[model samples]
Target: MSKKENAAPTTHTSESLFGKVNYTWMLIGLAVIALGLLLMAGGNSSDPAVFDQKEVYSSTRITIAPLLILAGLAIEVVAIFKKPKA
Candidate 1:
């Protein structure tokens, strides 16, 4: 048989890649935003209306906020690049 006649069969799936949004990415983005907000909230805000304000972090702990934020952003970006596990 000629090589052309023995070509591998290609299966066509009845779906478009752009048809759906990857929920994993949406979840990751939400988690990241939440974490970043939480980290930023760790420190005391200058609003008395915002009660339940306790300083769980200090000048030294301030580093944690940025770290968590950066980590969250990184995770979100990775999720975006990853294919949906389904």
Candidate 2:
């Protein structure tokens, strides 16, 4: 066998590139997104004969939820691109 083939492979340490703050922010953003999605959910009627247009077209689901989702996305983007403190 060749010397290069016989030599052991070098391995780097198992460590995350992002700091704790980045991970925290990411989790927060995820939670916010989850909250937004939850707010937008559950507008269905139990009865087939019943239709609630007001419930389906509520401002919370249409405007507030979408805004919250967008804010969460922005937070995620900022967290991903943010530099760690020295």
Candidate 3:
């Protein structure tokens, strides 16, 4: 037999690093982070001279936004670590 005939044919398959579920989770995390950022932004006064401490230091900005951002980061970690189904 010739050398080429003796060698078995090989097939290569391309696969994604992450599955659909992981991508979905990542998207969710991104959305959550974006929401947190939006919530944390914009305490601007109409006059620009006046600084509203209450608006800048509101519970949503100080507490909720940060918490949401943390939660989103955690979700991203989980998504990165999650195993894809075979």
Clashes of each: 0, 0, 0
* Cα RMSD for candidates in order: 8.6, 2.8, 2.6
Instruction: Score each candidate by Cα lDDT.
Output: 0.64, 0.89, 0.92
In candidate 2, stretches whose alpha carbon ends up further than 4 angstroms from where it belongs are 1-15, 43-48
Better candidate number, 1 or 3, judged by TM-score: 3
Stretches off by above 4 angstroms in model 3 are 1-10
Ranking by TM-score: 3, 2, 1
For candidate 1, the 10 contiguous residues with the lowest summed lDDT are 52-61
Ranking by lDDT: 3, 2, 1
Backbone clashes counted, model 2 = 0
Top candidate when judged by TM-score against the true structure: 3
Which 10-residue window in model 2 sums to the lowest lDDT? Answer: 42-51
**Residue range 1-86, candidate 2, lDDT tens digits:** 89999999999897677888998999999999999999999556787687788888889999999999999999999999988775
Better by TM-score, candidate 2 or 1: 2
Per-residue lDDT over 37-58 for candidate 1, one digit per residue giving the tens place of the 0 to 100 score = 6866665467757654245445
Stronger candidate by lDDT (1 vs 3): 3
TM per prediction? 0.46, 0.78, 0.81
